[model samples]
Target chain A: MTKESKKDGGVNPRDEAKERLENFALKVLESVNQIEPPKISIPSRSTSNIVFDEKERYYTISGKTVTRTSANMRQVKKFAQTMCAADFCKDLIESKKTATLREMYYISEGWETGGFADQGRSDRIVEDLESTFGVKREDLGLLPEEDGASIFGDIVIDEGGMEVKATKVGRAGYTIPPTMSDVEFVECGADCVLAVETMGMYHRLIQEEAWKKFDALVVALKGQPARATRRFLKRANKELDLPVYLFTDGDPFGFHIAMVVISGSAQLAYINHELAVPEAQFIGVTASDIENYDLPTDKLRESDVQRLKQLLKDPRYSDDIWQSEIKKMLNLNKKAEQQAFSKYGLEYVVDKYLPEKLT
Target chain B: MTKESKKDGGVNPRDEAKERLENFALKVLESVNQIEPPKISIPSRSTSNIVFDEKERYYTISGKTVTRTSANMRQVKKFAQTMCAADFCKDLIESKKTATLREMYYISEGWETGGFADQGRSDRIVEDLESTFGVKREDLGLLPEEDGASIFGDIVIDEGGMEVKATKVGRAGYTIPPTMSDVEFVECGADCVLAVETMGMYHRLIQEEAWKKFDALVVALKGQPARATRRFLKRANKELDLPVYLFTDGDPFGFHIAMVVISGSAQLAYINHELAVPEAQFIGVTASDIENYDLPTDKLRESDVQRLKQLLKDPRYSDDIWQSEIKKMLNLNKKAEQQAFSKYGLEYVVDKYLPEKLT
Candidate 1:
């Protein structure tokens, strides 16, 4: 057969298809920018050597040419300062907390990793709290009780209340003891004991426990409780029938620990069923307090609401009252902690925890 | 400190780290070919074109690649022929039987998804067997007497007794009626019948009601019968002296099935102690058969032996006889089956099952 006759049709299908494809390619190519010739310039100093063609609106010149000068040093410095200020403001706004003097100092030093200075400064702050405020290192309860004391001291309050204190920043403000170990719970002479936390608050509680001589004793777990601490609390509750009043920093993890005491998680295996007391209540630095006391809005981080919501979703948290309260806090998008007590000092907690009549 | 002195000791750590990384990259590029590439090839040619240079010399390709060429076409045809030959030789080699020309043709083409050409070819073969050899399909009890004429006329028997009779291509094979299911047993005309299967095999017997033929029938089930199948089998076994003959696939599953059949798996739901039969014997296709039969070297797949050994390791399968037999099979790496009858054909089976005196 002839090649043309062998074709499927009279039309040249391949050629027709190629033409259609070329048209589509042309349309796509039209979307891209067209190239242009670079602009040429001549300096006024080379005017004698240059020939200006008015008709063509073109000028020919010698080697010398004029160009815009680069940004001045003052402008550069101003730009940098503006950028730094913008970043600082952004971080402050994002965190909702003012950049501390120490943080600003670290940033100015160009230590992007914040270096050892940040950690050392934090340690110095903790040391100040210990020596200046007469906060016992043992009462700080930094290390895991099981490991004994590493950096921070173990604070065992009367009535099986325990806390870990640490100078270094890590997982918890203080290291928690392993779940397997037993915690020391001292007897502080009370039917019901209030475990006041934080250095200043603990000092006040000790003075109150001595002076008031009330039927209820006040023990201060100055730092976060180690795992053994919870077990000790459980033993105290079971043996002494002393109701546990947990107080901690007003933060997500702090709230979680209080809930852990009330509704034990799988982590606290030994005391899971035994240590958990359903009646434990969050006594201070609540959302209501944040609103009523007009605490610093900066203390409320953006993640606070989300973290509270997650804590509410936990199956272990069975108390509807606590759930509803936490939900309210999340709704308000705010959080408060008794550590704000540091701003007010020891006097504020005494007035808050122990009323004038009780004292 | 002088700026130069400070600069002398202080090198930018990040810059030094980056330099080291660049050096490492250069070294890696130098030895690019020395690094092994993944064995698998990418599926898409377009993507592979961007990532790999086909012209570059690299390690030898491990897998075969097919191309559309006349030589490839010849290889393809040869492969199909080899597979066909393997199928044809399977039974003959296994049973030491000579394949007839017709049997060879049937073996090669009969079991294909589609019906063989000349639809009545199998029927004609059966007719030749009866008319020319004086061996009737009914005499052999290959088909139920009710459907003897139709089945004998239509069924196609390959060198292996696996009969294939299809009305059309790509259709399911015709179901054999229970009466015609086991020709050898039906043709025996014996008083007592022993029907054994690897553990789970009894379900088919019970479903088929093939156990009702003899005065005292044994329905053997391999593997431990689950509660329900076991209960039903036992109820059926109890109704008549229908003793079960449990033949297993000579693997762990087989042994487990027997154990479950004989001693109910208490852990499983629905097991009944009374349903378990104590008299089941481990027979046929034992690991020992590999040695006894002198099977072709490496006939047993490695995976098969591994699985069998694992089954033998099960405490339930640790009986001295069972263990010894399994070890023998492991050493020889072979297995046997009742389906071996299919390979031996009518004469060999007749000699084996029915001697001259019995005939």
Candidate 2:
């Protein structure tokens, strides 16, 4: 709503969402006043367009659809329930409260059915609302579902007209916000954004104050960044023109989580254009890192091997770099998780590993 | 290079593909003569359009593109190789011979370096040729890689100007071909089309002459019907307008095969308009049937249970009928394959089971 009011620092995503919700409601009311059932249209995740952009080197949504209204009763009920969720989210943002999606889904559990059978069904409707508005639920002031990830560096944001120097406060940098857009990205002086897959390695860098030393924004992705985190990083890249680098475990799943941030997951493939960080390049915790750093003994699990075989056949992992890395893992019969870096001692991440891998 | 010449019964799908290939080659030659590298454009299988038709009650493709000459000489080479594949297919059909997709992929193994690294890659490019041309590879005279199912029934086809009644010639029935379009549906006097998911159940019926007894066309899908079989079924339904009943094991994979006939697979989501048969209904070997017939105790496998759990969460299996079936399997801690009906004796399928389930 109203083009994300640009303030002293940066645009506030929460305020923008709240304003859009108001405009959407007003439109619905106008339609109802004329006795027409408001057609609440959201991009259907079920009917998604997943395309690989060769130039940009990421998969993106090139096609999508609004929710169907052919089934009259279902359409009306879906629209009404989405509106209810939207209103609840607005209240959360305004009151400076945050909710996990589970909390929001069951917010009106006993009193009303909301016609949802389980948390899965409820979450889909919520996603419909998010995709419909093209605003993440977290940016609407919903905290992340998982208790993971943190941020550190010279980034300032406008929170309620007050400029917040994120890295200056607290002993270990800033605990990431629910919806990052609630705070404006006022300034990013960091030369680059370094996204890490695990919290252990992330905190090691924060404790070392690596962000300040290396002029980087150190973000622990906590294995697949929540929508808000991805959105924030995407915006930071666009607004600040910062090069982004990623580090994950030398395993299929860890690499998959990294891909989720870089190219977007197939489950939410439609939202990639807005959330994916295309400029991000794989830094390390690579298969080769196991030998180069001489970390620890490793053996790939059955499931790991299964996933590796799939990645071998996957179209997205068709690039030469990905092919070689996967082939290396298959041949070596090993996988290294992020925590394996701990074997090298704490300072190894900040001193030896980070600097060595960055180049 | 003209349209398929409609003969006595129906248009030959193979002849049509051959004509299309000729027309396509001429277009490329014309362009090459004008000094432009010939770009053979096929609807990219990688890029597909899936639309749910309000009127048709199944998904359909509404869009596509020919991944064409935007690239350099490499793209031209790729296009030429794919054209070469199409040419080989055309030759196979004209010679009244057939080859599996695996055979076709390896046809030029020792000769040209089309840059294909594996059968999987070769298969995808060949599939793209199918999707691009809106024709099945089987219709291009290629057979399935696996031998799983069979059918001997009332179906008749126009194979190279000769009419062949599949059920009449043999002691049991006619063996289904790779490309059903190679044979036109001459006469489907059967009251209904009964598609069986497994070979055991199909042969049981054929051996017992169940199709004759019940006035039905019995087909053993052999765990997912080839495109030729699916096309034959689809055409029979449209032209003959026969009610179709699918009988499979009361398990997730069986149901999946049934769905492949009814709605088409996600792998083939793009070509649904030509392939999917919407009116088909699951007739028997249902979860409830086990109880009704008092079939033997067969505990569900871990894999079966896993697939059932996935089916429980699938959007396609969202209907109440599907929900209860999956729930019943979970509740009973048991599953039944189509062969399980043999416990009641082979005649049970033709006599007691078919009559009871059909109603």
lDDT of 2 at A225: 76
In terms of lDDT, the poorest run of 10 residues in model 1 chain A is A1-10
Candidate 2 - CAPRI tier? Answer: incorrect
DockQ of each: 0.00, 0.01
User: In model 1, what lDDT does residue B289 have?
Assistant: 47
lDDT of each: 0.37, 0.67
Q: What is candidate 1's local distance difference test score? A: 0.37
Query: Can you write out model 1's per-residue Cα lDDT over A171-284, one digit (the tens) per residue?
Result: 111222222122333323345545544433443343333224434434444355544455546554665566666666556777776766666554332214434555555564
lDDT of 2 by residue, A101-133 (tens): 544544544224343555576688767767778
- What TM-score does prediction 1 earn? 0.25
Q: iRMS of each prediction in angstroms?
A: 44.2, 31.5
